[model samples]
Target: MTAGDPGGLDFWSFVELANRRLAEEYGFKHQLATELLLTLNRASNIVTYDLEASVHRPHGLSWSGFRLLFVTWLAGPLEAKKAAELTGMSRAAVSNLAKTLVADGSLNRESGVRDGRSVLLSLTDAGHRDMIEVFREHNEREDEWAGVLSPEEQRILVMLLDKLVTSRDQFDVRGRN
Candidate 1:
């Protein structure tokens, strides 16, 4: 399907087609391509897209921008590199977004004491206020998404995801030898 096609297949439909094609044409393993990783990727995209549309966009923030504010608000002052690590963003990306946030008065950046080359980031008073307000609505969206699964299922899913993340070094992203 073309990128501009309104009738383009939904994500799972594309995944299903890929799974079949891989199995038939390349003799790939069905379980590996169609199961855990694809499902997690799809869910992550949908959830992020919905959150951006429903909560972040109305507040004049992109999801990543909001996340930067949220992390700083929750963690107090942190070096830009630290913020990038905590937010799962690249250092350059965090630095760039920080520039906009600083200009907008949502965050403060100051030279680091321990390192002359580093900058520490913290929420400004206005930034803290805005993030707190936005977070209340963000939590509501989270609740709506979590409502799809029962509490037990939610707990189990969290545990499973944690397991995978914590064991990330075990997985080889490049082709296995």
Candidate 2:
């Protein structure tokens, strides 16, 4: 539906019809593929937004900034590219986020010792202490979100998602086939 449409469509009805049409008209292998992906996308947005507002923002960290610090804290010092790969963020984003974190005294970015062209990121002492406290609160938030599902249901969902995500070996960050 476009913005120029005369009437608004019911979301559930629209999705149900769209999936049926995909199966009938396009011969889709999975009729609910679009619906499943859309749900997952929405879930991601909701979780991230909630976490940022409740956990990260009060700590003076953006979501990207928090991820950078978290990864650096978990793994020791790492080059920007490695940080990007671990956090699923772009190298440029890691760079920009790292600058703010470093300026805030939460992270330290320095020229690589062995490779002068590379820059390494590591959490400062304050960052390490801060993250430890933030993590306690973060775990509580995680429990709140997961509590929506039964234990068995949550376990099954994790298993299924892991299988689907890890099954894709044909692609990489560079978009390689």
Candidate 3:
């Protein structure tokens, strides 16, 4: 199919074609791993984009911003380093996002009690209210996404994903926290 053709092939079709081509031309093997990783990444991106567009952007938050706010709202007043670890974001990113959130009156940043150079972040009163409202909508969207599968299937998927995540230590792969 031509690359510019709009209705030529769907995603799975493209993946299948690529797999066949790679196997034929490059002697590539590992199709199962390739397919699994591609499907996982695609699903994550689709859900993240949908959630950002439908739930977060209207409230002036990106996925990252919402994530920062979500973690802090649920588990503040936490050090920025802790927030970064929980959010799977870098410490520098947490610092920068905190500045924006603080400027918007949605977060409070204070000096750490034990260390002068450390920053502790917490949601403000308005931040708490906003987070509750936003989280209600967020959870509703999450429910809609999760509704595609049966409860047992969802449980199994979660278990499998957790297993994959926890098994990272078995390999030398470096990934987000």
Candidate 4:
């Protein structure tokens, strides 16, 4: 099976084979699929390690919780739908997590200005301090832990990740099975 000569292939195998064929056909190719999988996996591990090394100790901010919170920090005072879109999480998941964070006093939610139907979300005072502490400790650990990677390497890695995210839209991977 080749490009445009597609045969039966499930999602997993299809992506794998496509990556391989892409390298062979186009040459000097990046393993887009494997790069994506490993990038997510390595990121998860780094976050986990950083969280465990947190100095202030656990404050009910699991990795998933932190994920929701981190997005809020990045694009806060946002409507629920927009937050979900930025985090790449489902609206229901965002809503549910928002409820939990609100109850924990780590998030503040109110009615959206433009959309009466939408709810705006942001970090509460508690959430703000918590996020700052978490990130400070996390960044410290990152600097010490990832010391092997030079500044240029880190910059290159970030550029590659950004490129991969943008490339997904151009791939047209729908209904490839």
Candidate 5:
């Protein structure tokens, strides 16, 4: 029943033993499962923080910048408000990011045909190239992170995550408490 024995005492079982030690030896109040969940949340946050830091660019772009690039890359030659609707971002955000991307020459923006005041945005050749590189790097990073899983497992994981994200009842903007 030691850790050296494969089936005798596995990783999860070792966690159980440690849980017992904490509760029995030190008179810890919380249940083992609660403690485990808290530990899992902390680990998840730390990993996300590290991953974000690693992926951060010093080019003065925020998460909104990346998101704007993605939406425009997908649906460019698109109206500014239309891009905002598609991306689920605010009109102001799209307006500002579109201006920045236009300034950087990554995107092309012109006055709308129907409305002189309205703007339409499209990806320039450089924008497409940058998007291709970004997507390639993103795919490589995803593969590296999920390399332990088979392709089928990865598909299933994506399916499950998508379901969770798209389910309306799961989202709550305000805290219940």
Candidate 6:
């Protein structure tokens, strides 16, 4: 909101100004952590929005829908509970989305063989075919994003991210297996 602030300002400018304000007003000592999380979240949102808008939406899928389909396509004929875990979605969400997907002929929901109360979800033949095509486009966009970084930088970034994920246990934070 200062002289050089372009209206809402840009992400980096906001981060810079925020850190300065927090330091001046509160003597905040967590600026590094704040910046790291803000950058990571912004990057994630940007990439997710791009992929959903460009690749998934054109193929008639929302981000959540694509995630459900992708999981079923890969490890399908599995229980809805398992799919929920793999996709990081709630059981009820997966169940609801499954109804829509099934209605669209992209997914099939059936009673579990062992437990009649449990639901099993799988990609239909057409769904499988569509996923193959969509994933190709998805990977191309992923490659374009990765292309911005040198291979070594990419590798290091992945390693660091993996380390952070793996470290969740240290804080008693549970995550998908």
Clashing pairs in 2: none
| Model 1 TM-score (2 dp) | 0.86
Q: Going through the candidates in order, what is the number of backbone clashes in each?
A: 0, 0, 0, 0, 0, 0
Residue 42 accuracy (lDDT) in model 6: 92
Ordered by TM-score, highest first, the candidates read: 3, 6, 1, 2, 4, 5
- Residue by residue across 45-115, what tens digits does model 3's lDDT show? 99999999999999999899999999998886999999999999999899899999999999999999899
Displacement of residue 9 (Cα, Å) in model 3 is: 1.2
lDDT, residue 9, model 3? 82
The per-model lDDT (C-alpha) reads 0.88, 0.85, 0.92, 0.77, 0.71, 0.91
Candidate 6, residues 1-177, lDDT tens digits: the string is: 343645877889989988998898779999999999999999999999999999999999999999999988888589998989888988888989999999999999889879988988888999999999999999999999999999999999999999988778878785543
RMSD of each: 4.5, 3.4, 2.1, 8.4, 7.9, 2.4
* Model 1 RMSD vs true structure: 4.5
* lDDT assessment of candidate 3: 0.92
Tell me the tens digit of each residue's lDDT in model 2 across 12-33: 7677777877787778877567
* Tens digits of lDDT, candidate 4, 1-177: 235545666556667776776788777466875757865877768667666647334655766678788888878688888887777778888989999889999999999888799998999988998898888876787687667789899889889878867888787654211
Per-model TM values vs. the true structure: 0.86, 0.83, 0.94, 0.67, 0.58, 0.91
- Which structure among the candidates has the greatest lDDT? 3
**Candidate 4: residue 37 lDDT (0-100):** 87
> What would you estimate as the lDDT of candidate 4?
0.77
Q: Name model 6 segments beyond 4 Å from true.
A: 1-8, 174-177
Point to the candidate with the largest TM-score.
Answer: 3
| Ten contiguous residues with the weakest lDDT in model 1 | 1-10
